[model samples]
Target: MIKYIEKLVKKLKTSEKGQGMVEYALIIAFVAAIAIVALNNGLGQAVKDAFTGASNMVTSASNAAGTWATHKDT
Candidate 1:
């Protein structure tokens, strides 16, 4: 049993599988970072535009509601 345990420890210490997995993980992380940066640079304006449109819609709706409320009470 001791010899078997020693062999297992040696195997674990010499394994290169973990290193390959770590390399893959790093590559994926780098790709994800690049994607985020690209989106920030490329799509940032589009996102801002969308938010502005939404704000305009909200303002219009509020104004309509106010007009209706004022007229209903008269």
Candidate 2:
């Protein structure tokens, strides 16, 4: 049983086909970790607030334009 396990380990060590895949996986994992940290540290709230402010501005502008359109001749 030990010899079989040793042979498997040796085979894994000698294999090169999966090396690039492992490197890419590591990079993706690292980026995901940074994104998670940024979102947790107020970056997420800032983005939400920015979008909300933009939406409110658009709504106000639209309502103002609609009122002017309806009251143009009055």
Best by lDDT: 2
Q: Candidate 1: which stretches are off by over 4 Å?
A: 1-35
* Candidate 1 C-alpha lDDT tens digits along 14-41: 9986898899999999999987997889
Please report the candidate that would top TM-score against the real structure. Answer: 2
Per-residue lDDT tens digits for candidate 2, residues 1-74, read 99999999999899898899999999999999999999999999999999999999999999999999999968
* Shift of residue 6 alpha carbon in model 2, Å: 8.9
Cα lDDT computed for each candidate against the true fold: 0.93, 0.98
- What TM-score would candidate 2 get against the native? 0.71
Model 2 lDDT at residue 30: 100
